[model samples]
Target: MDSNLLRVPDGSESVTDADEEIFLVYTALNQKPTDQIGPDGFRGLGHVDSRKDIISIRFELTALSHPTSSLSKVAEDNLASKSRKGKSARRTCNHADAPQTIEIELAQDKTALRSRKGDTGSVLWRASIAFAQVILQQHQFPQSNPLFDKDLLRKSHILELGAGTGLLSIALSALAKSYTATDIAPLLPLIRKNVALNFTGWTYNTRLQEGSPGSNICVEELDWETLLSLPPARRSHYYPKPAEPNAEWDLVLIVDCIYHPSLLPALVETIETVCTAAKTWVLVIVELRQEDVVREFLERWLSKGTWQLFRVEGLLELPYVIWAGQKGVP
Candidate 1:
């Protein structure tokens, strides 16, 4: 269980109405500190008890599998088949082998899942899994981590840019107070499908350790091209607008979002808009598909001289690079 979900309460007296809704639901589900015991013999925290009852049903299908460095023989064969057919090569994220044993009922039409040539947004990416793993790690050690701010993540209005497969966003919904997952318009269908698939109707309300049901997760269309094309004054309107009026993003999660150099400019601009706010934080997971492209983005990013960037060390051996940063000088 993640204590981060239980770590921050009220999170300052200036809590917005949306935050109040999340906190109220969290309190209702988890219950207050009391001197009562439950019928199951264990005491306090109804959600924890709920976990005891649910573990048997939901986790039975989940297998404790480690991340794989190589694709399975079957995926390799699929790659070879696509190559032989002269079809554009697909970008296959390691999630195909990662711990997806939780039984998400995706569409049976496997053909539809295939990624089109030159468009990686339609497919999963390794950094998405890495980002989720990082979240779990922070939840495990909320106090020690220098890379991310626990309070910002726990109670803030959060957004995930290019939330491919909605993997990170799904995991985030259970942790963050309010999470909005965004991708291109066409991918919204697939993202929503994955959301519904992982979080069934009956279990959706009960899944998160915190946050109100329904308010915990939202899916929306956010295109970097379209957003960047908008006028400077109008670009803010393109952001994933929170239902709570006047809400600004406190944390932004970007997973494997920077690969193409052409999209880098817009992506960086979008990041600046979100992070320039006084207290916002951005956690980016880049899979370094191209060193030149990655370097270009880093250089462009540094040129602004605004963000105080921190490259998350020790994750170098992993499939992706983790970056945590916040705006400088407020």
Candidate 2:
């Protein structure tokens, strides 16, 4: 891990400087070999290793379509004050059209540093912040024009695979009708705690229980290997069927989950299972760390012949890339 990667920006720095500072935090992992990366452990987050501290990171949610800029100090102070006063962040936005800031409080336990594979979910990743920013700013453009369907998230039920710290759920969940965050068993508690930390009066059930009024944001275990092994007949046994019976998930998010090569089959299979409907959209975001690994995942995805892939060219400058896929559609 590069110690300078986490350098705090000075007050005199420009928005581009600050943006580059934060961007390096997540992209730093790209310098490492893909074989050395673990499911939950990212080398870039080395500072959180073996610690149990709750850290709060603030992301200035700006429009990717425009010249990117960080929020002004005055605006940030106002939002922080409102957050401290227990006010809803939605009410704190500058106006119907202005970009808003979000502070995500998360706990990271790198105790897995001792294990063969790391549990990296306890901390926030830069890719999640970038994705959330893109989501937050999508409304600025007409619904029909963005690379990601501007209307899909607004009116849909969203499911995020390998949600990690639940940052995306915490930041954008309430905007949708429903949002479900899923990961392996070990990371569920961290996701639930982080989600609860940001959302007042929200309680999460360990598993999506039967007939219980679904919470605004739900956290459930969705191990990819488990879903892949289950016969298609038994796949619905996984918690969180689409909000409507027999309907496919409206949107599926796969951000920064493409590191380990061994998990590619399981990951692709699970995605194919959930995104069965023609309208279901899968958004896959990966840091441009290892090109070969990323190419391999894309190859497997396209080889399936069921998904039609598309890219968001607007965000080409970012260290990560976004791909949108749908099944049985041209």
Candidate 3:
């Protein structure tokens, strides 16, 4: 019964005017009530008593997203201010050889932002940011690590799965010869928008792969479920085959994708399929939240025969691992 749930007790029936006021306060604060409905088949918003509490919640609503209300006007103003700042950021980036700035429009201001409950893919997860940091550190000191060997960046074709906000992919794009970010179809536009916003300097040559622009980075709709249902030969199609005659996906990057327990097996299968060639290497980073789900992924991944796992002992300040395929198996 978290506050976010906003559930009425099971015994409650019809919502009174007072009950409506409480529900109004809940929703007005940008909190969505659960699917539970009241006994009388109305919204399950039962009754509420404290007038002072309702007033306090009402005041808080101004900071949240509220359409058709005076509070929405404030939201608009804040976003306008952010836009001006965004322009300043772009100008500063152009002047200085600064790292590309990825503007994640949080639900508070951005039109593309969606509530986590509605679309978890739209939010910028910490794991994604941490993974990006790991890549930067490796790139800065490539000589120290064999995983990021001198030639890896120039020749590598990178693919990121469950790329929320496309942050990690965007960061890696500047390094890899080619990078692909994949998520569900609905999230493609938002991902593409983020790519275009950040990589303004990147060449827009879509003709890279045999008449294909071989764009440095691409955002494609790759439904994991669809891949899972495909025939065995076709399943490999989703997993990039070895491009350099010997290696499969010079490197595969995945972060924060193991939360859902049900999807663990599919995710594992996907990873195993992609790391088909012995030359392939996969770098996986999990945020370490949801201990149970993390445990499940680790157990499954540890037991999988496809990869010769290297437990990256504190390799990056962030959490991640490397999986090089079985030693010498063509």
Candidate 4:
């Protein structure tokens, strides 16, 4: 790791100081790196069986695993407080401290789940698992992590783009007030199925039907190419509506979504459209499977002057790099 990659702009800077924003870049390692690299790396990679028709994964939140870490006493107390407050106090079980477990059922071998023309997104990707762990670490240790803002998950509206299996959204849905997982039309059912596997109450569209309680997660279609064609006035029709008419999404999650170079522009455009407001943050996590695709994605993001990029540290090891891009100053 290069020492320069750790650099980031001061968070206290005013919105007017846009010129002072700096970009921290990290080149993915050509060789495969295992979870042995650090506690933050992907842990269950060795045990994953991609050949199965349906795969299930259980992850114990990293924030509660370490007794010596900052979350030790804090998590115990939080769990106790949640117990005292009763079921009404709990937002989602994922945020609770008692070894949060999210069981995601993935459709790896389904032909109907794939994108049109038979593309990826039907299977579970390794980066999404690493991403879930990283989110927990960042939320607990915001002072140390540059990319994540602890406040964003506190009753904030979160949207996930290209949410393949909706694993990441389901894993962290408890923390947000409302979470929308969007992908192509073909893969919407797969995401909805996976969401249903873990959560009790959820919807397939923006409108929340009555009787659906205990879950704030929803699955919808958000095609990047289609988003690019729509005008700014009509674009709002495609995006998932926040609870309030004036409310904007606080965070956008993009995990392992970048792969093909042809779709890079549409993806970047979609990011820009959603993150047009100030203080909106987008976390882009990509596996270093294709160098050209990753490079082009970064280049397009950087070309957009309003977006500032920061390289997230300690969340993932080589072959995986998560970039936190904010639309404007903190």
Candidate 5:
């Protein structure tokens, strides 16, 4: 990892520059070969020998989007706090107490996005990209099949839970009839920004055949744990008031959200509530970590018999499991 990638601003402590740099390095090293080239030039050699029938390998790294000038001002404000005083302040001056700053490239893919240091509050998880690609592959959009096939992509209302940067939802929205992306309140602005950045100058009419309906995509604030707990009137406060009451989603997407042991039950409950009316398909994308927490959670769901889980095949460049679910109850 490059040490310069880890330099934080002068005074911010919420996230260290080192943290950003380390995350960037890990993401870059782990991305699929199609995504980026390795720092050492081992091009797309996944468990294969270097001398094996070597086709021409191309090395291309995505450009990182620089943060706006305003970020520097925010960094200054976060670093220049005069709260420290007296003897304790002197003890804290041993470098650890200084504010840390990291320069981040905005809107880069998962790999480059991790190197950003700021209070953006958006958490980028590698599993999300893996799952998103899986979903795209399953539907065969912008690749094998046509764009707006009603049988495959259209008329499917998709909802992305905890959509940190709304990447998956953005792709789905481009293919599906409608998409609703949600996350915690803190992440809404960043999600919207990402959506705008990717969708700018995007023309779907040319891609789709004549008479195919366009996609409708919107970002909203939805705390999954509290979604169904709210009263009908209160629900409107969080979600937009649908013109009709039967506007249920056809699919629900969640990525890297089941890590916490306690969160699984709440997450399942939230999925059950939101997916009540429609014959919904739930797509969960998760990465296998050292801990068995995720595996245990899946087992609990399996024992209940309310849901069916199938692990979809993934690409060599991505480390993700695609667990797809259908209507388990009626």
Candidate 6:
């Protein structure tokens, strides 16, 4: 809940202003100390800082779940009171009483799904459950559609749909000249926090080695399920005019957003309505779990030639499919 701002060093080319900001915000959220200087005199927590051009942020479980003074005392007392009848007894008691920390990185451009470790085939972790891991993964794979090409993105106006935690949007904001980021109303606070944390100290001087003049990034509440039926009063909260139709986005992005079978149709309808003819591309990156449901949805909607399916490599080395609109076809 608390936040802090740290100034980036001038001679530091290994990390950008954005990387430092994210690191600080993440450390604060996990309730960890940030002023500790490492052996190299640089602030060290858990991320890889070797890359001079790219800013990499690392998340560690120990940093996220450091035991409080009272909790530590209780654990110590419990361990001390255990009887040493035998090595097995001591080991068993220690294992039961020991505290475990679960740490993860938030590098993904979209912070909507969490990465899992081991073969613990229990329920898969999601963005809502592990915010840190999802962010980390999104950063590693910012784009869902590799076929779209970098040249296409350079010239197009982009929109990120269901932009949870605003990681992809932030990436797009850095790449595209104009970008609009939208998600459910409830997530705006986190999205804004992330945007501010990443962009506050960023400068766009041509001489700066790390980042270009940052893009014009704006975050708003645009519910894909609501569409034009959204209340005029509520819509006005983010948009300038609620009644007027706005044709602003040329490309739409949906990352890790296709789990619910019922929402696919509504989501498509919203895309068709908001995006104009100039908006010829839609990138959807999702980890296919329920193939039956996804196949049925794609066969019904994508087969119509309105959208085309292309496969892209995911950050976790998984296969992700991207859906783009046909030029002048839809």
Please provide, for model 1 over 217-301, each residue's C-alpha lDDT reduced to its tens digit, 9 standing for 90 to 100. Answer: 8888888878789888998777776656776777778877776789988888888765544467677666534556767677667
Q: Summarize candidate 3's per-residue lDDT along 204-264 as a digit string, tens digits.
A: 3333333222246777777777777788788876654433465456567777676678888
Model 2 residue 276 CA deviation in Å:
2.2
Task: Give the Cα-based TM-score of candidate 6 against the true structure.
Answer: 0.47
Off by over 4 Å in 3: 1-80, 84-118, 141-143, 201-215, 238-247, 317-330
Clashing pairs in 3: 206-213, 207-212, 207-213, 208-212, 208-213, 208-214, 209-214
| Candidate 2 Cα outliers beyond 4 Å, as residue runs | 1-52, 61-91, 97-99, 113-116, 140-144, 148-152, 206-215
TM-scores of all predicted structures: 0.63, 0.71, 0.60, 0.72, 0.53, 0.47
Clashes of 5: 12
Which has the better TM-score: candidate 4, or candidate 5?
4
Instruction: Give the per-residue lDDT digits (tens) of candidate 6, residues 1-330.
Output: 000011111221221132342343334324533222221222312112212211222222122332111111111111223322111101111242243222211222222322332111111113222222332223223334223334444545666767665555543454454566677665665565555445544222211233333335566677655664665455334331211155355566676566666677656666655544533455555433455455545554453344433332222212223333422344
lDDT per residue, candidate 5, 246-321, as tens digits?
Answer: 6666667787676667566656656656663325667666554423565555655554456544443322133344
Instruction: State each model's CA lDDT, in order.
Output: 0.51, 0.60, 0.47, 0.60, 0.45, 0.39
Q: C-alpha displacement of 68 in model 1, angstroms?
A: 12
Query: What C-alpha lDDT does candidate 1 achieve relative to the native structure?
Result: 0.51
Top lDDT hit: 2
Candidate 5 residues lying further than 4 Å off, grouped into runs, are 1-121, 134-150, 201-215, 228-245, 314-318
- Cα error, residue 20 of model 6, in Å, equals 46
- lDDT of residue 47 for candidate 5: 20
Rate residue 239 of model 6 by lDDT: 34
Worst 10 residues of 1 by lDDT: 53-62
lDDT (Cα, 0-100) at 152 in candidate 2: 48
Q: List the residue pairs that clash in candidate 1.
A: none
